[model samples]
Target chain A: MDGHGGRERQLFELGRLVKAGLTQPLGLMRPGGVGRILAVRSGEGDVERGLLEMGFVEGACVEVLHHGFLGRDPLAVRINQAMTVALRRGEANAVLVGPLLNRATDVEPTTDQESRPS
Target chain B: MTAGTLAAEGFRPARIALVGPPNSGKTTLFNTLTGGRQKTANYPGVTVERKSGLLKTPGGHPVEVLDLPGSYSLRARSPDEAITRDVVLGRQARETLPDALVCVTDATNLGQHLRLLLELRQLGRPLILVLNMMDIAQKRGCQISTEALSRQLGIPVVTTVAMRKHGVRDLLGQIDALLNQAPAGDGVTAISDWVEPSPDAIRAHHREVERLLQEAVVREGAPEHLTRQLDRVLLHPVAGPLILLALLFLMFQAVFSWAEAPMDWIDGGMAGLQQWLSAHMEESLLKSLLVDGIVAGVGGVVIFLPQILILFLFILLLEDSGYMTRAAFLMDRLMSAVGLNGRAFIPLLSSFACAIPGIMAARTIAHPLDRLVTILIAPLMTCSARLPVYVLLIAAFVPATTVWGGIGLQGLVMFGLYATGIVGALAVAGVLRLTLLRGDRQPLLMELPSYKWPNPANVLLGLWERAKIFMRRIGTIILSVLVILWFLSTFPAAPEGATEPAIYYSFAGLIGRTLEPLLAPIGFNWQIAIALVPGLAAREVAVAALGTVYALSGDEGAVTEALTTTLAQSWTLATALSLLAWYVFAPQCLATLAAVRRETNSWRWAAFMFVYLMTLAYLAAFVTYRVALALGGG
Candidate 1:
């Protein structure tokens, strides 16, 4: 959805891990870092389905918002800005990701709003 | 399709069910629809709650609405989900199939919520898709084309902010029309034709929802702005835990300090009633029973209500504000280290208030092993019932002086007891996870709901319901048990006034004497033995039993004043500390045991819990007594 079509997709795939070496597990993303989910590295269980059912589908945007204190075991990831999911680093390891297509959030200073409900 | 046409036709659905994914605001919507009229009980043979309430449409047509447990799909995984599935599929014998289904979805998370809607659609019931939390979605600048989405799904859909308490006018009319038109939804019960969706089917459904989302929903603005900003600090590594600790410390301190005045009022009121009764009536058995048994016994238990409310107030606020999940997030590492799911934190924390609700809350934990482990250790969480016992013993034995600047020594002991409960639970959970019920740890996959100011109405309503439940327990169970206790201790009065209290010759006295030898190793006398017997009815009842026992023995003062002095004068410091240690591990509450039984769906687990807890209690008391005696406190 970066407004580029198959040509750009092909170019990115060609560069793959070299240019987009940032690709890693969602659990390893730094705070405020953005990533596009490629797939969940599922094993033998419903973890894959559970994550998918929670909207970790392909091409979904995810950002690591916060990490737990000790060893940063559990990380809170904002999925597509629609839902915030808290999963431990082990479970979050299932989510494979690469650099986001859109770098708007990085370029544009974040907007703030006083939306706190009383 | 208007409300008038449905009313004119006298067509009203007999029952309606609210179905949704977890955290879809389904319960809030149910509250909006049913108002304050609701009954919550267990489904047959399961721990899942069956909440039904009566609601009338704008056209004045009555409908029975059920608030089902939130589920991701009809293919049930947990007991809670099983109930939702069975009831919807007309497989639950105790519950008839809902006449029409109200499928609720969170508009903000339509990308995910719609997948469940798509699955529910396959069931072929008359469904009205409700997009709840529309206000939040709108605030986040999500543009959802309701008409297009409705047309695409071939179902009626409406947007609602259920928290607003509005009639959800669009939904009200839609329900009226759908129910009127599809009066025979019951006849569409074709359970066998529905096969459980494989993972591939789930993926296909997800694709379908993605397609629908692309076509009908447009996203804009900095998504989840407030939540992201708040989490930056609240979920920070160091400061987050410190804040959680501070909040918990403040909550416990408030439970003692804030409740003092109210507890005093109730104590004085009960004492006044007892005094008045004694002054007016003759010195007869009937008069004695009225004052000592009823007033003193019930007053001892009721005095702790303020403390219970204070504890629950903090819990309710944290729950409604959605910080509880974050706490679980932070605690997940430690929990998993001790072999528990992060979701166990909610139930375990609530266990400090009472174990019954804690055990019931475990149903939300999908893994049976995690849920069982959570339930088994729930009673060790120093519930509010134990507060009266701890407070009474501390006030009588421990100094009331402050430990540091404004930190009370007594409050420190109370905090220590709470800490002890948590440690005990964690240790036991570790051992259980390793020894019996060993399995792969449940993954941490909980939704961290957006931070919002807790809805005051919901918080207050929840507090009131708990308060009512507490008072009902006192009014019925404690009152009746005390009456029976009084009779047992009063009848067969000491023969020929053998120079001791009349209770010494009573049936209760004989039983206490018989059990004294068994408890003697732990420094428990006959009176403590007698109290421990009836205390099994409820932990708080032990406080009442102590009050009733000594008050009947003669010249013992009233509950709040007299029982403290009486126990202080008689029990050695070793015995007092030993008793406190006993309560910390004792599974004295029958209600908690019954809850564990029902939740585990077996007497075996309950019996195991009882045996382990009793063993721990006895060992704890023995060690405390010996150590205190060796230290010359005895």
Candidate 2:
């Protein structure tokens, strides 16, 4: 799948669909690719501050640490160090991200590939 | 020393900490258990404070009941929960480990409330489960078998209706029985195993608890009646906000209208007492000190007690009715847009009555940064203390011109001042979030409790507690500051040939004169400058200080009348507006500063807060003064 689009593919569309907790997306692996933080959506004012204070800022580095059962919200992420924080799916959905950097073999194939335009 | 060490020291009383979710009736339980016989004071050493009271067990032995901040679980999230965890685990430095734990859980919400119970059970303490709000549960057609729950949990279970004092005797009996049992030793059971266990383990525990609950609990549908009808209108998107605004307007009007008579009585009483003291006693400095220094100064602030009490009564009623959480929910969306979390609404709302408790209440927010941000901005909300100054200024200067039919111009101005504070807080929070505490927004996940009629007793007790605290401040801190201010405005008798009063030669006059240049940009005269010094103790103290300073500045016979007339004659509307603006943001209360220090546990943050707030106040006042002056007001 590497450069299969012959240099015409968008950088934002390169992440694999891995089964992980939706709520805690920060620690979930984007095996073989790096992702960019797109936006944060939260209903509460303080929660946004909390996410930012905890280093879940826009344009910050985030990597998946572990996945919980059935790809729910509890995903661990490595923002800077090996340290991880568990977030719920409701909270994780508020954080929008783009494609990850570099692909890994251990990652599952993207399930939403059909939805992505070539 | 660790809390465990403190517990081991053996000098401290055996501590019994009450932990529960908010709206679980923990405070009502605390009040019922302690009654008015107990001493209610802040926790020693730290500001993440606990309310401790004395409770006598059925066996007639005394036990210290420490009402810890209400929390949903043992998970150390907010400062309030952190305090509960530390105190329970014997980890907090200044607090001792609770010898016994009373977990108050609302019966109506058993599944959710049980999580905390389970967490507390794993702590291996001698824990007792108090099923609070049983009356509400019964009203909702909920049935709980206490015996079955006790058997399931292997702990004593007591049902209590704290508001009406129902089942309290039985609950006390259970506490006595537990206290007689041997204390648990040093082995602390790990709670992580329960929550982060293997999938099978988690499933098994869940199944077991479910089965236990199935057998022990029976609940019908929630009652649908007046509360639902009220909430329908109160929680409407448009009507809710309108009602809130209307309620607030009425509350302010009540604070002014209802308090006027008592205030007059207090004022008259103080004047008569002062006169009597001066007449009966021999002419001595001590006599002058007693009447002029103590009576005149403190009395001025004490007269405002009725207003403060009335304001607090409304707040307590609102809180007790369980409508506060709904208001928070309604406000969350608006607050989030302005960089404040929804949880900030309660604390800020509470600040309208007094910033001290409002700042203290910030512990409920789960995020530290969010709580700190709320605490830092709370003082800007224009507490009840500022009302007297605002009222005095408005009554003296602002013409009584109605805007629309039946809408008092004075009330409109009061509303405008409050709106200004709210706007200022939002602006500051937004700036701080963008520049300093820049971070992602946290999601607001708060439980909205079913509404209930506020227990009259609890409301009365809350009002009484606030009234007492206000009185104590007036008696001690305000009293002391007033005496000092009086002395400063007195002494240094005027020269024999001088036409001016003795106060002109006093230290306050000299100090005020020196401060004139610094305050001139804000259009404050020397007397106002002198008043601002004592105002640092409390915002309302400025009003009293003004009364005393002006009283001592001239003839005593017509002080109050002369002072009001002098203010009207000397001060312009722009000056009043500028001063009001200054107070809207000024970090004036020592109590609030002390609380911030206690909450943050760092002097750096406190100092930073002081400097930033003072700068804001000065700049705001200066701008207002200049703008008003350009408009030809002063």
Q: Write the per-residue lDDT of candidate 2 for residues B352-463, one digit (tens) a residue.
A: 8777778877877877778878988888888877877887788777788987788989878887888888888889888888888887666565544556677787888777
Which 10-residue window in model 2 chain B sums to the lowest lDDT? Answer: B194-203
lDDT of 1 by residue, B1-634 (tens): 5323444466643678999998888888888888889887768788676888987777566678899999888877788898888888888876766777899988877777888888888888878899888887777766878888898999998889999965387887887777567755335553557777766677688789868876787544345667777887888898888998898879878987898999889878887887789889999988878886787777767777898788888988998888998889888888899999888988887787788777877888888999999999999998888877897899899988986699999978887887888898999999999999899877777888878888777788778877886787678767887788788778788777486566667777788889999999999998898888767767876776676567543322345567888888999999999999999999987767777888888999999999999999999999999999999988
Model 2 native-contact share? 0.02
lDDT at position B479, candidate 2: 69
**TM-score of the second chain in each model?**
0.92, 0.86
Please list the residue runs of candidate 1 whose C-alpha ends up more than 4 Å from where it truly belongs after superposition. Answer: A1-22, A101-118, B1-13, B165-167, B218-221, B279-290, B400-408, B547-569
Clashes of each: 0, 32
lDDT of 2 at B287: 89
Q: After superposition, how far is residue B527 of candidate 2 from its true place, in Å?
A: 4.1
Candidate number with greatest DockQ: 1
Off by over 4 Å in 2: A1-118, B1-15, B59-62, B94-96, B135-141, B145-147, B183-208, B218-229, B402-411, B491-496, B534-536, B540-558, B571-576
Q: What is the lDDT of candidate 2?
A: 0.68
User: How far in Å is the alpha carbon of A55 misplaced in model 2?
Assistant: 26
How much is the lDDT of residue B320 in candidate 1? 86
